[model samples]
Target: MKEEIKKHLENAITSYHHYYASGKLAAYIPALLEANPKAIGACILDKEGHWYCAGDYEKRFTIQSISKIVTLALAIMDNGEESVFSKMGYEPTGDSFNSLVRMEINRVPKPYNPMINAGAIVVTSMIKGEDNNEKLERIIDFFKRLTSNEELSIDGKVYLSEKETGHRNRALAYYMKEVGILSLDVEDVLDLYFQQCSILVNCQDLAKIAMVFANDGVDINTGEELVPKYIARKIRTIMVTCGMYDASGSFAVRVGLPAKSGVGGGIIALSPKKLGIGLYGPALDDKGNSIVGMKVLEELSRKLDLSIF
Candidate 1:
């Protein structure tokens, strides 16, 4: 059964790789302009610890917005859910991932949830550290544990480029500071946020991390708690409700998995007790999610009975 499932997934990946070149790579961030717009990869880790990879699974990609999951995980591990929720939020708002409607309407102005950009900036500040370096290391360490890989770190070029052009994130930071929701210095918090987004991982590493979530935060091999079970559940719920930029609802309907995507053409999604999957393709839709990646997931869901509901 495992081998047959793997073959079907690989065939699907091969059939879909060409679709990436026909779409748009996110060009607003100049650093992302050069990714082979034609590239894609997919990997799945089943509950039994077997690995299956297809297409460019080894291709290196930055996590980009997908790092929100990492930073949020770190904040939960350090501060516990209660403290983290007090500052950010939990409900999903139907706005752009970076939209600030709540800040404009609500007294506090933080967004509806931590999965979006504003809430993510707030979550970034929640990590307990005296300085940015310490905070960043904690995030990195968390990623290492999730992926079981020690070498994960920021892509220097992507980090520099994003830092150079992160004006909107800067605005979110300052406004969050203005409302007193964000307790850290605007500059310091922005620095850490940028650094976190630049953390690099490929499809397989992301799949391994997703496997931890698939197992409800227990590492199958080590029987260790990488994240508290409820914490993992909360994060995955957010992923289902708000992980895709503006298309999260539609994605949930079509793909039926709790997943998160990044502008870097990377997505980490998982089927509980079944598989954790990662897909990458540099081309993007207007909402900043990978176009081919989304299609691949939709097809995978239809064929594999992987949807949650």
Candidate 2:
């Protein structure tokens, strides 16, 4: 059965690889711009530890905004639910992940959710650490644990690139601070947020991390509960509603799973108790999601009947 599934995926990869050209690479971050827009990869990890992969799956890239999912989970685990959500809303913003228009228009101006840049910055500040370096170390360590990959680390070039070009993010942070939504030093929190986003990983690493989430926060292999069950449920709900930025609702109807996408052309999604999928494609649609990646997932979901809804 596993071999048949793998073969099906290989055939699907051949069909989807051609769609890469329709989307463009993320150009805002100079380092991310260097990625080969044509490259595509995917991997899946089943509940029993079976593995399947195809097309540049071994290639490494920065995780980008997908790291927000981890940081949000870590913040909730470290600071508890009430403290974190008090500063971040649970609803989707229905705007670009980095947009500041809503912040200015809303009366209270709390970031709609932790998945967006403004909200992510606030979530990073909730990490328990005396300094920026310490906070980053804590985040990195948590990622290593979730993926079971000690070698995972930030791409210095990408970090530097984002730090240099992330003016909008800086403005959001400053605005958040001014409105009292963020109490930490803007520079300190922004530094951590950029560093976290630049953490590099391959499709296999992402599949493993998604497996942990698929198992409801308990890593089946180690039998260790990484996140509280309740927290995992909340994370999954938010991913379904807001993980894909403004296009999340459409994605939910089509793919029907709790998933997240990153600007580095990576996506991690899961089907409860079934499998976890990781995909990468440098080309993006108008929504900043991996264009080829979404098509591939849609095909897989339809073939396997993996939709939760």
Candidate 3:
């Protein structure tokens, strides 16, 4: 069975490499522009702590918008899921990942939830911090604890590059501030938000992070509860409903795993007590998701019969 799963993973990566080359890399974030658009890697962790990998599985990539999931999980811990949702929401949004369409159509510019840029900025504002660095430290600490990797650190080049080119995100933050939905200073909040997105990790680290949710938020190595059971369940629900930006609904139907993606071509996906998958392919489809990443997950799900639906 181990050999079979290994072969399956290898086949998936081998068959899916071309899909990465066809898709474009995320260009809006200046730092993401530097990634090798052709690199495709995957890491899968099974229930028994076994690891299976293929392709460029060791390469590090920016967390990109995927940082929203960590911020949301922390918000749920700090403010409670009910309070967090009271301010945001859990429905699938049809707009682009960074789109501001609802602000013009609706009376309020506030976003539907924390997965989008607007909502992520608002959520970052709520995290208790003395300053931007401290807030970023808190987020990094959580990721490190979850991944059991003390080496986790921000890619400062990525952070500064994103900050330099993040006019749209800045606009979104300011608009939220205008409506009383955002309380923190816009620059400070954005600084924290962008820094979190700049956190660096490879497929191995992502797989460990996903396993926390897969096992209901307990650190599998230590058996310590990192998040409450209810909160963990809520995290998975949000991943399914909103994690892929606007493409979340289709992802739910096809991949059927609790997952999130970053524009840097990284995806973190998991099956509860079953498996955690991390795929990195620096090419993105129209929806800002990793194109080859999705293909690999779909094939794995089909062959492994893994689905949360």
User: At residue 241, what lDDT does model 3 achieve?
Assistant: 90
Residue 104 alpha-carbon offset, candidate 3, angstroms:
3.5
Worst 10 residues of 2 by lDDT: 3-12
What shift in Å separates residue 236 of candidate 3 from its native position after superposition? 0.5
Model 2: per-residue Cα lDDT at residue 15? 91
User: Of the pair 2 and 3, which is ahead by TM-score?
Assistant: 2
Please, what is the TM-score per model?
A: 0.97, 0.98, 0.97
Question: Across residues 1-309, which tens digit of lDDT does each residue of candidate 1 receive?
Answer: 687778878878877777776689877678989898888888888888888888778988889888888788878888888888888667778787877666789866666888888889888888888799888888898899999999898888888888898888888788888888888788888888888888889998899888888888999889999988887888889899889977998998888899999999999999987788988888988788888888888888988888999
What are the per-residue Cα lDDT tens digits for candidate 2 across 1-309? 798668867887889898888998889998998999889999999989999999999999999999988999999988999999999799988899999988799888899899988899999999998898888899999999999999998999999999999999999999888889989889988889999999999999889888888889989788899988888888888999999999999999999999999999999999987898899998999999999999999988888888999
Give the clash total for candidate 1. 1
Per residue, candidate 3 scores C-alpha lDDT tens digits across 1-309 of: 688779989999998888876799778877788889889999998778899999999999988877787788898788876777766666667898777778657765568767888788888888877787787788999888888999998899999998999999988877778877887788888888888889999999999888888989888778999978888888888888989888888888998998999998999999998777888998899989999999999998888888878
Deviation in angstroms for 103 in model 1? Answer: 1.9
What C-alpha lDDT values do all the predictions have? 0.85, 0.91, 0.85
For all predictions, the C-alpha RMSD in Å is: 1.2, 0.9, 1.3
Instruction: List where candidate 2 sits over 4 angstroms from the true fold.
Output: none
For model 2 the TM-score comes to 0.98
